[model samples]
Target chain A: MPEHESPIVTVDIVLLTLEDEQLKVTLMERTKEPFAGRLALPGGYVHTNTDQNGDDAARRIMTTKLGFAPSHMEQLETISGPTRDPRGWSVSIVYVALISREALASHSAIPLHLYPVAALPELAFDHNKIVRRAVERLRSKGTYSTLPCHLLPARFSIPQMHHVFELVLGVPLNRTSFTRKVSEMGILELAGKEPAAGRGRTAAQYRLKEEVSFFHRPLGDGM
Target chain B: MPEHESPIVTVDIVLLTLEDEQLKVTLMERTKEPFAGRLALPGGYVHTNTDQNGDDAARRIMTTKLGFAPSHMEQLETISGPTRDPRGWSVSIVYVALISREALASHSAIPLHLYPVAALPELAFDHNKIVRRAVERLRSKGTYSTLPCHLLPARFSIPQMHHVFELVLGVPLNRTSFTRKVSEMGILELAGKEPAAGRGRTAAQYRLKEEVSFFHRPLGDGM
Candidate 1:
């Protein structure tokens, strides 16, 4: 196939985080003609000259547009069709990244806005569908992996971790049951620290085990 | 970007099935250059003229190349980079499909070969990596969904179903435990039929319930 006849390939990232107990995704206002002044996920065309792969392009886009690197990133899905982009057929290798809200606070070079995943406004292109897919991936994987930990600091209390899980899953879990399940996963270790001041009794802090990628076993009920 | 300078986009499918209690995948010998006369997954360039999206391209590829349509198909991953394809920068939207051995037996227009997933020979391009990703997706999803049913006929006995799951999961599940788990999922309905001619007493047959997409809850422990 001739180059122009082929679809244009790009990378759009769904950068997710927890803000005030609500799941939010990063969005930016477009400054180009295709969707000038409209809100869209931060993305750009693949730089074949410099990028080694789509993953590289996604990381570069995150750094240059969002001003920080995500601690956890994975290929979410690829959205493509003839009607996705007005210019022509376009294929976007969408990636999902999880980061702490504090990570974004220190790097605010770009004028990006964080909107709750459920209450997102009209976005450019087919980004709304992309964000929905990312959220589904996160919530489903949250049951089996240490995914919610990406939204927390290095060390956190069991109660704090439980709250994060509840927020992502949208279902309140029994306190005793949640803690026991986390303990059984064997992916977390005691950090030898106490919760920060000002909240009732000080709860012992825990951190993810070093070099652990994900839990070897399922964390919760499979669904 | 000029037409000639852009990367080419294509779709490749990892079609999987079970044969003789072993997991097998379909491969075809490439007739064109790049990797002529070598074993590769049945795939081709995206047909922008007719295909509305990658999903359509994948289905078309299956019909034309494999001479059969898969029962289940989903977007697996998009493999992209300058190094993936030898003919310059190319992006392949990989899809995972599940079919039954009987389906392939009925449609034999194309000369395709079935190879065990574990003992695959040197394949053309980066197809080995694509096949590996498909297997991982299948095995992980097998824990929560009725995925192995795609490898069986419409109606089958419990023992036959168990064998299919064992082949895909590579683990022997206790008959009692597996039956209990399947009953709890409520996705299968008794078909009011007896097993086909066999060596022993006739067993009750079951089929997947109509309009069932996936289980509402997880099915079993993660592998």
Candidate 2:
């Protein structure tokens, strides 16, 4: 096969976090051709020489583009088309990384541009579509599973988890029902200490026991 | 970039259907090098000039290898690694297509090899892993949505749908409760005429009302 025979392959990561109760995504300005100086998901070509697989390629891209890679990275989906990139036919193995704003602020080496995923500007290639797909997965999983719990720090209170679910689902949930739903799922464990609230009451704290726990019944039909 | 710089990209499809009351997957023996004469998922190199996208490549591979593509095709996860392929790092965009045995028999131009998903033998590349992933998705979706209805014919009876669910879930469901659960889902519309069962009894007929309907509550926790 000739050089033009294969489709251009790369890895793109959508790093999402919560800041000021708004879901934000990390992006960088491409300094190379095909979208130079334009905002895009932090990504680059797959280094076949050093990358053992897509996971390796994703981690390498994140480490190279950003200073440090987030601990939790998930394989989202692969997007390919003839026109998605200025280069010939291309395939992008996408990943979704979740982190807390506080954690990200401590690790980032470069000046990171964070944008609200709901109000993102025009991005390079089909990145905007990829970001939307990742967000859709998170939102859909928020209904019945503790997937959105990844957006929170390792230790989170039940109320904090409830608020994260509301933020991801983009709707308010009944406090009691939401707490009951989490209790029914049994995916959370009691954390060490309780956090003080405005009323001088200590809120019950919980930590996720699994990466993701799905209960048959949903908290509320978000979609 | 050199020829080897771009990873080889291909499309593989796991065509699954219900046959003899068991979940069977379609595979073909490869006739080319790098695993010639070995059983593998129906797939081939991505035709960049012709294929519009991954969907096109999957459809093309199915049509060329299996004579016809299934009516319902899902974009399963993509698999990639350097050691998985002998030549170089490769990316395979995998798909899972569901069709009834009756429909498949009518469309296949050549002899097809059908194997039970649970008893799969060694296959070329990482096809077994891909098959398991597809089955896992089906099983997970089976617990909460009308996804398994796709494995049946377009219009089927309630008992027929129940049997298909049992096959996918590998569990016998209570007859009355299963019917009630599906009815609550509101995913099935009356398919007009009833099918006569044994002993002068008639079974109610129903057809899927949506591509996929999620009722929040699952039929049962299959996983």
Candidate 3:
């Protein structure tokens, strides 16, 4: 391949969380051309000198652009084509990250706009497709993995955790069935605490045993 | 990024199939430096002039090197690092492809070697890691999708298909339960045929419905 034909490699991250009972993704305004001033995922070029790989680049971009590390991160997909970027044949190693709403509220230095996954605005450089793919991956994995825990606070009640899963999965889960299935997975342990007063009946708080766990069976019958 | 620092982009394919009741992958002897005379996955540089994207490059490499198109192909992962390729900073868009064993027998012109997934030889570059990731993805997805069909003939009996799944999953499935679960999925149709003489009991032939099916529930219990 000629020098001019070399593809520009970049990493794009779709950071997702549940805010106001809606599944939202973080977007930043691009300051450079090729779609200047448009909303885009937090990303940048793969620094050959300072970064070791795409994962490193993604983490660096997240910390530098968002000012916080995500609780959960995984490579979603690689979007590459001739027309994805106007500059040249570029490839974007896309990733999906999850952060708790409380964490996002505490770290408010970065000027990021949260948009509902269903009602995302016009994004820059085929980012809409990238975000869609990430959402699908998140929901698909949510069925068998304890990925929803990352979208909640460290200690949360069963109802709060169920709400996060329902929002991300776009379905209402029965409270009894949800609690039973989640408890049966053996990934969550009672924190031996309760919510503050005036929050209706005091629901027992639970915390994820570990970061994530893949269940041998699906959490529910189907989404 | 400067022109000299441009990353060398390529596509490496992990083509898997069942051979002698063992899950095997295809590897070729490298004829160039950076692991010459060693076993490596079939790969080539992404043709900026002829190929549109990594998918196109993967298919092109398959047809040229393996002389057949895979029944199923999907992007596995993109491995990029400064030390992965001894030449320079390079990125390889890896993919996983599956073709029936019968197809491999018919198109046996290429000088390729088959190695079982259990016991693999020293592979060139980080191909061992790439192949491992592909196997993980295959097994993970095999639980809910009709992915094993790609590793069998176009038309096969239920028992033959069950055998393929058992070999790939490394578990013996109960015939009664396996048939019931597969039938409940509604992803297979009778081919109105049976195997020729000399085979075991005459079993009804079946083919995968369309190409593939993603079962809402797992086809069977945990492997």
Candidate 4:
């Protein structure tokens, strides 16, 4: 392909967070064509002159568009095609970013627009397809990893973690097994104690040992 | 970026298969400038006009370069940088493909130059780093999924599947436990009995119901 017809390459990020027990993705109105003024994932053309690589492009986009970095980010898949972007053939190295509600709230002044994953407005380009793949990755990884933990506060009680799993997996887990399984993974450490809940009962708070962890066993079994 | 400064975009594939119980990756002698005589992963510039998407580009390359299509292929990740290719900025959608030794033997006329992954030559560009990530993914997925089974013949004995896991994960697993776990996953069906071993006892051959299946539990616990 000639220089003028070089595949229009870019990077797009699906920044996801849980708001009031509902999973949401941040979107912004496109500031330029091919869909100016329409909602789309935060993204831009790769700065071949400045950006070192795809990861750098993702970090730069997050900083410039979202105002805050996600605690957890991963390359979900690269979305490419002739029709994805109206400007000739284009490619987007799509990524998924996870922010806890607490983390998201800390930057509330940015006025980020979030829409539920289950019910998204028709987004610009192939963004809706990109978001679905991101969710699929989240759900698939959630079955055996502490990935959803990124959806909770930096410090959270056991029940808070349990509730997030149920919300994301759409299945109720027995509380005792959930606690034991998480404990066995050894990905969490006791951080402190939560202020008393109803009935004046205090719950223990914990912090993840890492950004994410995959369990030896899927949470679906024996839960 | 100006038309003349457009980034060079391409796709590279890391085609891996097992040979004599050893993990090997396919490479071809580079036929172009920058690394004309060096062996590198089979790759080419993406046909922006003819290829519809990344997957399509991958397929076209497989057919044109290898002549035989792989039974298992996936988008591992996209690698990009200014210096990866001598020709300006470039992006390559790296893919990993798995082929059974049996399948590869059938296409012996292709004269493929496969190198053991454990001991690789100095590959062109960042191809070595790309190979390392592909191996990492294969190892991680081997722990919980029947991914390594792709290294076996389409119809294989139970012990053949178990040995491939051991080779890929670099861990020995108890036979009874491996059998029980695989049975529970329900991803394989008995195809036929293998020719009798030295003891004059035939072993059952099984065919994977799908290309791969993840077990609810890792093959790490219990005998």
Model 4 chain B lDDT-worst window of ten:
B214-223
- TM-score, chain A, candidate 4: 0.89
The recovered share of true contacts, given per candidate in order, is 0.50, 0.60, 0.50, 0.57
Runs with alpha carbons beyond 4 Å of true place in candidate 1: A2-4, A107-111, A195-201, A211-223, B1-4, B107-111, B195-201, B214-223
Candidate 1 lDDT over residue span B30-118, tens digit each: 99888999899988887666777777788788888877667577787787778778887888888887778887777657766899999
**TM-scores vs. true structure, each candidate:** 0.89, 0.90, 0.88, 0.92
Query: Going through the candidates in order, what is the number of backbone clashes in each?
Result: 2, 0, 0, 0
Docking class of 1: acceptable
RMSD of 2: 6.2
Query: Looking at candidate 2, what is the lDDT of residue A40?
Result: 97
Instruction: Please give, for residues A130-211, the per-residue lDDT of candidate 3 as tens digits.
Output: 7877777778777667777788888898878888888888888889988788878888888876756785657788888864
lDDT of residue B115 for candidate 3: 92
TM-score, candidate number 1: 0.89
**Distance from true location, Cα of B174 in model 3, Å:** 3.7
List the DockQ of the predictions in order.
Answer: 0.39, 0.40, 0.36, 0.37
If both were scored by DockQ, which would come out higher, candidate 1 or candidate 3?
1
Task: Please tell me the interface RMSD, in Å, for model 2.
Answer: 8.9
- lDDT (C-alpha) at residue B108 in model 1: 58
